[model samples]
Every structure is written in C-alpha cells, then in structure tokens.
Target: MASEILAQLQAQKLLIVNPRRKNGLIIYKKYYAEFAGPGAIVGGQFDCDAIAVLPVGKISLIVPQTPEERRQAYKMRRQWVKLTKQITDNPIPAERAQVILNQFEHWFDAQTVENLPDEAFALLVGVLPQTITKVRNNGLF
Candidate 1:
C-alpha cells in the first residue's frame, strides 16, 4: 500500500503558479521527491524565479477552469511577456529581474494593490502594461 501511494505520487504532475507574469502556470512533471528539501516552498523549488506549487486539484480550485478564468490567465501571461521585454530594455540585470519577478509573485499571493507597500506598487505600476492598470488600481490583483 505504501509503495502504491509512492508510485502515485511519483506520477503526479503539479501546477506551478508564477502570478506575476505570462506562462506563469507550468506543469511540474518530475518526481515529487525531487522537491523534498530544506528550501522547498510548495512542492520543491524549480528553476523558475518565484513560483507557487500546488496539485492540479488545488490550482483548479483557486483558478477556476472557466472562460473568464482562461481570459484572465491569457491576459496575465501576455502582461508577463511585456514585463519581460521591459525588463530587458532597462538597465536591470536578468538576475535582478528574476528577483523582482519573485517579489511580484509574493505580492500577488499576499497583498492587494491597496495594501501593498508603496514602493513595490509603484515599481510594478511603472513597468506593467496599461491593460493591467485597471485591476491594479482597483486593488483586485
């Protein structure tokens, strides 16, 4: 029975959420044990800058599988791509941009625009696409 459970776990594929950018949700196809370590934050750390890992079941709960959700997801992914381009255009190094992306991911999960730290909010607002401004300003994201 234990081995059967372990086998099931090994076959599981988790969804990783990088809330700040496009292509934020990725499938984690590797063994779950690979992420069992000291630094493991939500299933185990991957090469992604800042990602939240969860089972597909859990992700489905948080992100409904609906037309509206699909629209929002696609929009966020496009914004993420734009954000990456902006980062490339600026003097900020790729390493630093990754850090910034991670910060945004945390902010997305933890705080609303209204409650977010001013500096962080300002930095994002300055670089983010205009399409995102409405949601950001309304404190909805």
Candidate 2:
C-alpha cells in the first residue's frame, strides 16, 4: 500500500525524502516529501509514530503513531500551523491549490492500498470529488 502511494506521489513529481540508517533498514521512522509548482517548497516526514504531510510552506497533516503520540504531535502541529499560514498567505493562484489537492488524493488513495474494501472503493469514488471541491474552495494546499 505504501509503495503504491509512494509511486503516485513520485509520478506527480513530488519529492520523497526518507531517512536512512546505516544498517539499510528503512526505519519506518519518518517518510516525508513534497511537491511544489515552479517555485515552491514541499517536504514532510514519516516517523515511528506518524505520517506527516507538508505540501507548501510548513502546514502539515500529521497522523501520529498512537494516542500517546498526540501529545508530542501537538508541538509539531504548532510548527505546521505557522508554516501553513505562510503558504496560504502567499500570492499563489487558486488553481494551483486544486492541483496540489488532486495529487494529495492520489497519494491518500495509495496509502490505503492494502485493506481497501469494496465499499471503501465506492466511497472514495463518491467522496473524492466533493472533497476536492472543499479543498479547492478552502484553498488548502
């Protein structure tokens, strides 16, 4: 599932930066990457506890390891809030945001490759378009 998501993100030209260990054990610590238009910066991390997505600027959607990790994530969330605000404050066009979200959905879908039930597949088909609309309207990049 992760590989599929990784492929989609890569296909979209999003940079994927994974932390490496000397033992060649891709420590599932943090996997982060980002995609930007002509002049944008995107990056993120997947750690022992969470998967973080920082598309533009520093705003992030962090999926933590466990309920306990939420406390630590709170600190990271503050940083993301500051970064996201900066990205949104920029003079980027609205259309650009849509492009980013479209890529994000592709990535999100990839993340669920393993256990995607038939019902979920239908739900995704129905929900994705609306979700994209909401993201576009909200200018969430």
lDDT score at residue 30, model 2, on the 0-100 scale: 40
Off by over 4 Å in 1: 1-63, 91-141
Report the lDDT tens digits of candidate 2 across residue range 59-130: 222234454554444444444335434434535434334444444345444343222232222222222434
Evaluated against the true structure, the overall lDDT of model 2 is: 0.33
Give the best candidate by lDDT. Answer: 1
**What are the lDDT scores of the predictions, listed in order?**
0.33, 0.33
Candidate 1 total steric clashes: 1
Worst 10 residues of 2 by lDDT: 19-28
Where model 2 places Cα greater than 4 Å from the true spot, the runs are 1-71, 99-103, 110-141
lDDT of 1 by residue, 21-53 (tens): 321222223321111111111212232322222
For candidate 2, the per-residue lDDT at 36 reads 22
